[model samples]
Target: MGGLKVLCIAIVLINGQTIGTVAADGPFPDEARRMRSANEFLSPALRAEQADPIRNRGMLWVEQGERLFAQPPPPGGAQSCASCHASPETSMRGVAARLPAVDAESGQLVNLEGRINDCRILRQSLPPLDYETDELLALTAYLTALSIGEPLTVSIDGPASAFYAYGQQLWSERQGQLNVACTQCHDQSVGRKLRGDTISSAVPTGYPAYRLEWQTLGSLHRRLRSCQLGVRAQLFELGSREYLALELYLKSRARRHLIDAPALRR
Candidate 1:
C-alpha cells in the first residue's frame, strides 16, 4: 500500500513539472514568432532616415567638429587628428561603418570614438576627452558623417566573446533592491511606462544622441553606465574594457536597426 502511494505522488509531481515548463516557455516562443513575422514590414527607406545623415543645411556641428579636429590638444601634444588621418575622403574613408569591433590584442570591444581617443592618448600622449563634451560630440558627428551611407559593422569574436557573454549575462541578471534585469524592462515589458515615459524598444543604433532628459548629447557608454547606476550596480569606468565589450554586443544586436547617429531623442 505504501509503495503504491509513493508511486502516485511521484506521478503527480512529474505531471506538475511538465505543466510548469510548458507554461513558462510556450508564450514566449509564440510571441517571438509573431515578432519575426512583423519584422518583414520594415522599410529600407525608413531605415535610411534613421541613419541620420548630416545634411549641409543643418549640419553646423559637423563643420565645428572638423575644425576642432584640426586644432591641437591642450598643453602639449602631437599633431591634431588631421595630421595622419588627413582628409575624410582618404583616412576617414570606410571608417563610420566599421566601428564597435572586437580587438583581439586588447580583448575588448572598441567603438570609433574609443579608437580615436586611444590614438590621442597613446600616440599623442594626451589625456582622453570626456564623454559627450563639445569636442567629443563634434568629433563624432564629423566622423559618422564621413561614412554616411556605409553600413555599420560590428564583430563578436575572440576575446570579445567572453566580454559579450558577460554583458548578455548582465542584461538578463536581475539587479537593484527592486530586483530587475534590463530584459525585464526592455525586452519582456516594452511599451510600458516607467516614471511617465513610454518605454519603446531599447535600441542602440541611434547612439551619441541628444537626450531631452539630460538636455545634452551623450554617448552610448554613458547611457549604459547611467543605467548601471540606476540599479545601484557597480559602474564601469569610462572607455573600460567592459564598456567596449558591452558596446560591441549592443551594437551587433542593433545591426540593421538604423544608424541614428547624433539623434535627437526625448
Candidate 2:
C-alpha cells in the first residue's frame, strides 16, 4: 500500500512540473507575438540597475569617459574633447541619433566611435584609439548616454543607401558551419531560451552594453563579431566596412526605438 501511495505522489509531482513549464513557455498571445526589445522585458532588478546610477555598472564607464573628455591625454598637443564641445549634455546632445553618417572626408560610412577617432587624429593630432580598449568603450558609452531617450535615426538614404542595402543582405545571408543566418536566431528565437540565455532582438539601441557574460562593456560591433564567431563564421575586423554596414542596418531596424545604450544584458 505504501509503495502505491509513493507511486501516486510521484505521478502528481511529474504532472505538476509539466503543467508549470507549459504555462510559462506557452504560446504567446497574438498581442505578445509583436516583437519588443529587451527593454520592455526588463525585470524589476534589471530596471533598477538601469535607473540607479550607482548600481548601473555602465555608469562607471560613462563617468570615466566624461573625465577623459575633459582631460584627454596629450599626444601631439591634443586638446580635450571638452575644450571644444564643452559639457557633453549641452555640446553632444542628440549627436548619436544622426550617426553612421557618411564622412565627407573619407567618403565612407562612420559610426560615432570612428568619428571620435577621426577627430582625435585630425583635430587633436592624436593617434586613433584602438578598438575595445577601456578608454574607447568609456568614451563611446558617454556619447551614447547623451542620446538616451532619443529615437534611433540612422541615415539610410542617399549615400548611405548602398551601405544600408549591403547590411540588409548580410542579415539574411547564411554563414558558419551551422548554416544559420542572424534572423534564424535573433528574429525567430527572440524571447526564447537558448543555451540558458534569453535571445533578444538584435537591436543596436542598448549597445556599448555591459554584458554580464563578458563582465565588461563593449561596442555593438564587438557584440556582432562575437555572434559571428559563435556560428563559426569568419569574423570581420572592427570598424570594417562590413561591420559598419551591418551596424547601420541594425540601427535602421530600431529607428522607431529609443536610444538606451550602456544597458546591462545577461
Candidate 3:
C-alpha cells in the first residue's frame, strides 16, 4: 500500500480480546459502510490502556479540566464556564461531538478549543489561552470526555458550507516534499502500515488525546500540525482557518462515529 509492504494488525476490544485483523492492503471501504474509529486500529495493550482510567495518562488532563471549569472568574469577571453552564455531566454532555460549528453570537466557526478561549476572552474578560497549553488541553479533555460516546454531528449547512468545502479540497490536494495528500494515507492507504504504525481513517474522535510519542495530552490541531510536518507541507498556525476547515470536514466525515476524547494512541 502506497509503495510500502502491507501489514495487518490485530483489532482488539478493550477487554483484551482480538476481534480481527484489518485488511491493510484492501481498497477503501464503501461510504455506505459504517465508519470505524481510529481506536479500533490500536494494539491490544494500548486499547486496554485507553479503557482504564488509572493507566490512561490522558485522564489526568481531564481531571485538571474539571477543576478549571469550576474555577471562579478572574477578578472583575462575572462568570466562569461552570457558572453559565452548570455541571458538565448535564450541560456539556454531547457538546463536543457537535463542535467546530458556527458560534451563534460571534458568527465565527469555533471548535472545542476555540469555544473555551471565546469564553475566556469574551465572558471572563481575560486573554485567550495559548494553543497546546496545559490549561486549554485540560479543559478540552474534560468537556470532550462528557460526550465520550456521542456521535459527531457537525453541521456544514448554511454559512458553514464554504468552510466544509475548503476542507474537502484540502484533503485531496497534494502538497509537501513527499507530494502526498491526506487521502493518500488516511483514505486510499488506510489500515496499511506506515513506519510500523497503522494508517487509520483520519477520524477526529480522539482529540485532546494522549499520544505515546508526545507523552502528554494534545489537541486535534496539534496532531494536524504534526501530520503537515511529516509531509513537509507548509504548516498553519494552531487556530488557522485552514486547520479549522479541515477539522470541520473530518468531523463531518466522521458523522455517527462515537467520540473517544482524551483517547490513547500510539
Candidate topping lDDT:
3
Residues 196-218 of candidate 1: C-alpha lDDT, one tens digit per residue:
65555455644665565776667
- Give per-residue lDDT, candidate 2, residue 39: 69
> Model 3, stretches more than 4 Å misplaced?
1-34
* TM-scores for candidates 1 onward, in order: 0.70, 0.84, 0.86
lDDT of each: 0.59, 0.76, 0.81
**Worst 10 contiguous positions by lDDT, candidate 3:** 12-21
lDDT of 2 at 7: 19
Tens-digit lDDT track for model 2 on 208-229? 9898878999888899998898
Write down the TM-score for model 3.
Answer: 0.86
lDDT tens digits by residue: candidate 3, 67-139: 7788787777768888888966868888998899987777778898898888888888878899889999999
Candidate 1 worst ten-residue window by lDDT: 11-20
Between prediction 1 and prediction 2, which has the larger lDDT?
2
Pick by TM-score: which candidate is best? 3
Ranking by TM-score: 3, 2, 1
| Global fold similarity of model 1 (TM-score) | 0.70
Off by over 4 Å in 2: 1-35, 72-75
Total backbone collisions for each predicted model: 0, 0, 0
